[model samples]
Target: MAALALRGFGRRCLLARLGPGPALHQTIPMATTAQEEMRRFWERNSRSGRPVSPHVSIYKWSLPMAMSISHRGTGVALSLGVSLFSVAALLLPESFPHYLAQVRALSLGPALLCSAKFLLALPLCYHSWNGVRHLAWDLGKGLRLPQVTQSGLLVLALTLLSSAALAAL
Candidate 1:
């Protein structure tokens, strides 16, 4: 009886191991599917002969656009200038006036000196005036097309005048 029981158990274990436990299938490739979708999207949206969107080359230039770009540029320039100046002040010996005096001692030509001064002053003036213009716009002023154009002009004029005065000094 014991021998029969052992033989039956062994046969059951062998049948279980040989039976189909789970079904296995190959995975669908996802990367190929994604690439195909992207290609189809681009093909649908692309223009045949003409450009799809208006580029910088297609748009006409205007003063307001120029001023807007300048305002952003000046803001970045002023921020960078102030950061560098602060770092120099902390690292260099002596004080700010010492550097100024050293530059003065160089005896640089007036034209070149004034030009350097203008370059330094222009960004500050432009950023400040443009900041004021932004504030005015925030206050619900200069919303109209004409007002926007006039305010842009005023900002440029103020920037030039302030830069000139500072450079002269």
Candidate 2:
């Protein structure tokens, strides 16, 4: 009786290992099919002689276009500046004044130092004012072409004015 029960258990285990019914471990060749399809697509597109999309080199420069790009760039710069300042605040052994003192001790020329400070402040000011302008547009203000041009000019003027003020300090 014991031998018979052992044999039955062994058969059941073998069947379980074989998996339910005849749907055994199947190898799908979908990857090769996808590659072939992609190859065909490229071939078709190539044969049709349709021009590919133009890259950035194709676009002409305009004031509005330049301002739009600068807005994005300044935003990224400000975010990175804040992140670096936060990291320095946490990692530096001494307080903020200590670092300032050390920098002062370097005796860097005032003009050069002020220029660097101006460069940093300029982007921040530009991005901030432009961001406000963007928000105003979002609220359905200044959407007209004339208003856009005027607001863009305002953003530039404010950026330069504020940057100069900060540098003077």
Candidate 3:
């Protein structure tokens, strides 16, 4: 017990010589909110001239990079389309047939109609095919550079063909 007391005294003396330091369990209250912290972090980073991400400005566009961007864009477009459609369905007073009839009344040209249909189908087809490619990547397949390029091309081809078929239908 005496030795332990001496050890504690020695530690106190050492600390006293060292002057005050942060406590092991010290809780420092935040002076800024998370938003302010983030703002400051961004400001610092911007001043340092560091890229915020793998920005397109720094890297030349590649097939894989484009495909990755398209995948995300299509996913977002599909989600927003569905969400807006659902909200419109809930809020709009008109029934489905009413809108259908109105569209028909427009008597849009066949080419325009087909183009619209293709646009609608394109995002779905691209997202689905790219998702399958991503699944293959998860399974440790089609991950090599050559294989990734091949798969991206295949996804594009399939998306175009499938979307065209749907548009024709």
Candidate 4:
């Protein structure tokens, strides 16, 4: 029935598909240029101070949601950090030990050294922890909302502790 009705669209018989509605010969308005029509629509919406789509502000924050986004961010940061470090290692005239000696020569305080170590360890630790969380998810575990929240908190805690432990070294 639908196929026959669709075929009717190519003829005036489309009016019959409307089920006793107005005749097909009636005139209806159409935008000749879709671009101009869309531009006008956006312009009108802008003037009316109405949002055309949902904004980030409309979304309510949740623990798992935040952790998930941070997991991806840390993964990107770790990859970029390692790649840039490798490229710099290849291009630099000095070797790794030379750079270590240069840093030691700076005589930066232990507090500063620890802070720098923490900065280097932070993304790695977070990424590693979150990766394990992701692995668990793949194994069909910790998928419930409560378990996700608990695991997210656990990942954060472990990241902090492990990063500190690494920095201490």
Who is ahead in lDDT, 3 or 4? 3
Q: Which residue pairs overlap in candidate 4's backbone? A: none
Worst 10 residues of 4 by lDDT: 15-24
**What TM-score would every model get versus the actual structure?**
0.72, 0.66, 0.67, 0.72
lDDT (10s digit) by residue, model 2, range 108-140: 999999998999899988988998999999999
lDDT of each: 0.86, 0.89, 0.94, 0.88
Model 4, CA-based lDDT? 0.88
lDDT of 3 by residue, 1-169 (tens): 9999999999999988877656734778889999999999999999999887756468888899999989999999999999999999999999889999999999999999999999999999999999999999999998899999999999999999999999999
- Give the better candidate number (1 or 4) by lDDT: 4
Give the Å error, residue 25, model 3. 34
Ranking by TM-score: 4, 1, 3, 2
The list of candidate 1 runs beyond 4 A from truth reads 1-32, 47-61
Query: Which 10-residue span in candidate 3 carries the lowest summed lDDT?
Result: 18-27
- Cα RMSD (Å) between model 2 and the true structure? 7.0
Clash totals for all candidate models = 0, 0, 0, 0
Candidate 1, residues 61-138, lDDT tens digits: the string is 788888888888888887888899899899998998888899999999999999999988998999899889999999
The local lDDT score (0 to 100) that residue 64 gets in candidate 2 is 77
Candidate 2 stretches greater than 4 Å from native: 1-51
Clashing pairs in 2: none
Top candidate, metric lDDT: 3
Where does candidate 4 stray beyond 4 Å? Answer: 1-51
